[model samples]
Target: MGFNEDRKRYLAGLEDKTYFMLGDEACAYGAIFAGCDFFAGYPITPASEVAERLAEELPKAGGLCIQMEDELASMAAIVGASWTGGRSMTATSGPGFSLMQENIGYAIMTETPCVLVDVQRSGPSTGQATKPAQGDMMQARWGTHGDHNIIALSPNSAQECFDMMQECFNLADTYRTPVILLMDGEIGHIRESVTMPALSSIKPAARKMAKPGEDVFGGEELVPGITHYGMGQNVHVTGSTHKANGMRDVTTPHVHEALVKRIYNKIDDNREKIIRVEKDISQNGQSKIGVIAYGATARPSLGAVRAARDDGKNIDFMRLITIWPFARKQVAEFAKNLDMILVPEMNLGQISREIERFVNCKVVSVPKIGGVPHTVEEIYDAITEVAS
Candidate 1:
């Protein structure tokens, strides 16, 4: 059978049961089920719970969990673990996310498969240690220097927090790159009922393995297979510009261009498969207004859209499940048939500006910061103003 059918059967075989849990705890569960055999992370607010729960659970599952000295070491540790053929990950907040940028770039250059969970909080240096914010939206895409592509998913509720973590790991393995679960503090700490699949029935996806003598770094394929350490493959992985065989070729412009383009195109070329969005758009040509949101802002946006519809208003609503590679085509298609698109985010129009790139309609950004999520009434008011 084909890969897609096999994946569907594996998922359908999982036994699911509901549990009331924190978003952070659910992430821990998702990682374990996704066959994460190594976790190395340092404790940080809003994200500490992920490490804490993994510390308690991983060992029982015969997995290793390490509380690293800092975010840099934490990131480096996971990269090393993945080279040993382990599905590895780390969890951290904004400051820690920043500290890992260099290594994150290294992971991309090396084509490592791993997951990074960023439970975002108010930032620009510890704005509020305890509260949540969606300020890290853009940073997840461009925090690391140079031209590259990343896959980031944002969860609006605790349930999504659990569900998306597995998808993150799968995408990482499939693409052979680091994937980020861009969770905000609100959803990370929020308690909700999550349906978790039984561990015994879980079957996670695996990355392609390079056979001996095969080029593990690059080849005719867009994403080359990877070889673990001690695999009898003469693999030379480096951050410098390299050829298809993974040898350093720092002085050749075409070599650098070819390698970088392949890395970027691996994600860009597969945007249709990578991007995901949830839409409740009006189809009767009655709505001229649409609301687009992600993360914490999505919760209230949905509520407001429903309330507005109850009040006889024609408004469409969409929630972005996949945050990076920018969902360019999906947003553009969502913008069609609308005169105005309202974007409510916890940051100052981070994603709205991206939407403006793809559509002809007037884009309105309802930005909120200082650790507060947009309320349903406020979003409803915005919809009403646009409709009037």
Candidate 2:
């Protein structure tokens, strides 16, 4: 179908209403509201609800929702769909996400604009399909091969899952790169009341289209626009090194070097514009410690920080909304004059490593694995330990 028709059909399926729903289901509705007309995903725990809902709802909206044989095909299908000039997405948990890495790399290298939702579960390999863990935190940033930059957002609540899915699509389209919504299974399965804003309030990013006679990958614009396959653009897309016209140039040293740098720089240069975080600092401006957390773990950390404040401690809390393309500048500024910073995560010090890179203060990691979130007391104790 044509772009307008697909978009109109998708828009017709949206309703600006409030409802209590699981994060996964909220994500599905968010996709539809965001004008996503194509969904290709394999069923996996905690993330299966997303595909299930889309399977029923997408077709009704005149879109296609295909259950691929496996995660590999699912990831590939979404990339192919994006070339057809439609928004596409897929959802998966740990094992399935791992299976999608190679194709995820292809999507990144080719600059395909699409969304990927990884509802994290306990894992090394199928460690616990139904349990929650933030083990995939680092994988979302580096699971795909080679040196590349990708946008990833973390949603700590069902409302955020509903809200950030649209942001994910916007970021993906705006940059012509795959965006990941790194959600944990706990949040995915938790049900919460969500009030969706008016449809008009959501501003989605439009895809940049190459002008007639312009090379698909050629432009002074860092993120070059793309033309649909049959539009006579004659674009050649490959995972290997390519020139502005998209022709494969695997042997040319300069061609590969230039293309790779452009891809990486597109994100690096825009890092400030992309990174987001929620901060509550010392009101009296005497905070000596800060707590940094993301994903589901941020929930408890927020509570712990509040309790610490009640006890007359100078504690600042920063919740990460953008996980990848780490908010180095923001955190570094927050870290200034602070005695220490504590990071509480569901895994063993994944993002803590990144936090340490940007901050000069004492960085402490409070990791809790085995499919459970850190309690308020646990986080508070860690804060106390570091503060002392």
TM-score of each: 0.95, 0.96
Candidate 2 lDDT, tens digit per residue, 28-83?
Answer: 98887777889999999989999999998878777889999999999999999999
lDDT of 1 at 57: 79
Query: How many clashing pairs does model 1 include?
Result: 0
For model 2, the stretches where C-alpha displacement exceeds 4 angstroms are 1-14
**With candidate 2 superimposed using the best TM-score fit, by how many Å does residue 279's alpha carbon deviate from the native?**
0.4
- lDDT scores in order: 0.88, 0.89
Which regions of candidate 1 are displaced past 4 Å? 1-15, 199-201
Q: What does candidate 1 score in Cα RMSD to the true structure?
A: 3.7
In candidate 1, list every pair of residues with a backbone clash: none
Worst 10 residues of 1 by lDDT: 1-10
